[model samples]
Target: MKRRTFDKLVSFVGLGLAALLLIFAGLLNFGANFANDSVASQLENQNISFPAEDAMPSETKDQLAKWAGMKVVTGEMARDYSDLYIWEHMKGSAIAVMGKPATYSEVSGVYMGLVRGGSTDVEKIKQYGDLRQTLFMGNTLRGMLLEAYAFGTLGVIAGYAAIASLVGGVLFLLLGIAGLMHIRRTPEDATI
Candidate 1:
């Protein structure tokens, strides 16, 4: 009701919201770092490489074609291959497979396709399928490394947000304290 009280309330609310944002940012950053560390540890435990020869076994290619059934491969199918075919075949230090080195951004784009729906182009599906297979299977360690990089990037963004939120929180808290300190009893002088 009083101007001083209203100012105090507003300031406190602002400070509280700022504090929450700061906390959220911290959690996000921590999560990102944790993800990165986990990936790093996994990568460090193994060696990864892309096969010089990018050849798909005829049987495997046939199976993929059968699965395709004249229609484009669905995201679900891609994931299935990643989980089943790729995961099963993945072994030893070699982790042999086909295809060139794919950038993280390219892999991310393919992943986005999986999240969205699927592609109709047979070649795109095959390329992405191979990409996912190699990334998830043969080069699992490298894949983890890529994932860690992504998480680290996210952490950097979160860190920036955390710093901003912390600054805002401190400012709001200081303003609230100042408002309370400067409050006057007289109605005319009560407004902060």
Candidate 2:
């Protein structure tokens, strides 16, 4: 085959792979949004409180500021069958954040404005909201926590896809180049 013909074929394959990546990335984003919506709806039907800006209180806000300042440990905590991993898992990312951790205090108590996780046990959550109403009683931090959690989820997914795509995309691009080189060195009459 001629060099131009070979180049065109390589270009076609490259464009096809790029198109597929575009579709894959779109689907992943769509799925994430859908999941977030469904979980939110379910929580609402259950009458669970979602944290919001208005739900926050001065005391809880201060506590959150403190928690943010504390040395955050990013290691996995024993929760259930698999340990609940810390918010960030990027190489050294969690550790660095922990190095300057968010602050909290047993004294400042609870405040509203925190979002709840669908996966978190409802009962355990109530303990924080209902039972401890006397100690700390506001809805502010809950929403803030939930929002932070959602962002963490997004970061993990995007980071993994980015890393994997870089590896695969580079490998495929190299393979396409190698195929072109092979065709160039071969005689015109030789079969591919």
Candidate 3:
């Protein structure tokens, strides 16, 4: 094979790869921006205003009790209660009652049952409703915070990927240009 032709081929391939990388980087950046915007919009729409204290309004507590009373999990639902219960029964109230979000770690702890207190008797259910309210609020706050953090992390990763890809693309392009220059300086008939 001719040395000039080989260099030309390498140059073209490198340039092509660079172009592809740049395009990929652009797409990744676009996706990251879109995701960030979406998350921000969703958060704004939810209007979460976490409270300073772990207290729920009396009306909210009553509503929680009513919802709890209405819940009749059966079979698989009962088995999946942990997964479904908080999200289904408490998410809206918890978000509203919380008035603001908590950190992901705090919420995850609640979700994982790490934040739970000692078991209470059935007779003490009414008396401990306030405690339940506080727990619910914390759980809700944690869930939202965790979701936001996840979205933010995804955006950050995408941004990093985009930056890496852009750098790679630029390096590849420079190498391709250098190869083309080398080809130009070599004799056309030079054999490899």
Candidate 4:
């Protein structure tokens, strides 16, 4: 091929690579957004309440104070009183307080567990119930899997890796068309 043809090929390759990158970026963004939305939906659907009250059981306070500096709180002891659990419980309670129509399928089970545990005080029961994990079950894993699935599904539907892929394809197609027209108009330019 002549110099002009070679240059055109190089330009096309560059465009294609840039498009691929943009598409991937879009996929990442969409995945993150979808995962967040899913989490919010699950929280709402499961009726997991939050914790925001002056009343905290001694056990809960001890546990929470221990893990207050950490972002993630798991394991047996922390399960009862971590901020994560409190946040979930508070949200659920807030919904009830607001008189919103929501109910946990496991409400009875939760109450029974508290009763069996001999924690009649609402604050104490809320603190140690370990119900958050149950309400938003497998939340972390679900978020990751959801993101991957959403990105993959979008990739197939759009014929690109991400939402940005569409833009990439459009720009690529336009450039290709323009280049082809330029070449046809100056076929002799290739020889020069």
For the record, the alpha-carbon RMSD of candidate 2 to the native fold, in angstroms, is 14.8
Which ten-residue region of model 1 has the weakest summed lDDT?
47-56
Best by lDDT: 3
Candidate rank order under TM-score: 3, 1, 2, 4
Model 2: per-residue Cα lDDT over 1-192, one tens digit each: 566576658856975675566566566656555544544444344343313423323334433332332232211101100111122122123223234322233222321322233435555455344433422222233443355445446645765675566556666667666666665666765544
List residue ranges in candidate 1 displaced over 4 A: 47-144, 184-192
Worst 10-residue lDDT window for candidate 4 reads 71-80
Which of 1 and 2 is the better model by lDDT? 1
Query: What is candidate 1's local distance difference test score?
Result: 0.52
Q: Write candidate 1's Cα lDDT for 59-102 as tens digits.
A: 35544444432221222333334433444354211133224445
Task: Report the C-alpha displacement of residue 72, candidate 1, in angstroms.
Answer: 36
Q: Which structure is stronger by TM-score: 2 or 4? A: 2
Off by over 4 Å in 3: 49-123
TM-score of 1: 0.44
Q: Please give each candidate's TM-score.
A: 0.44, 0.37, 0.58, 0.34
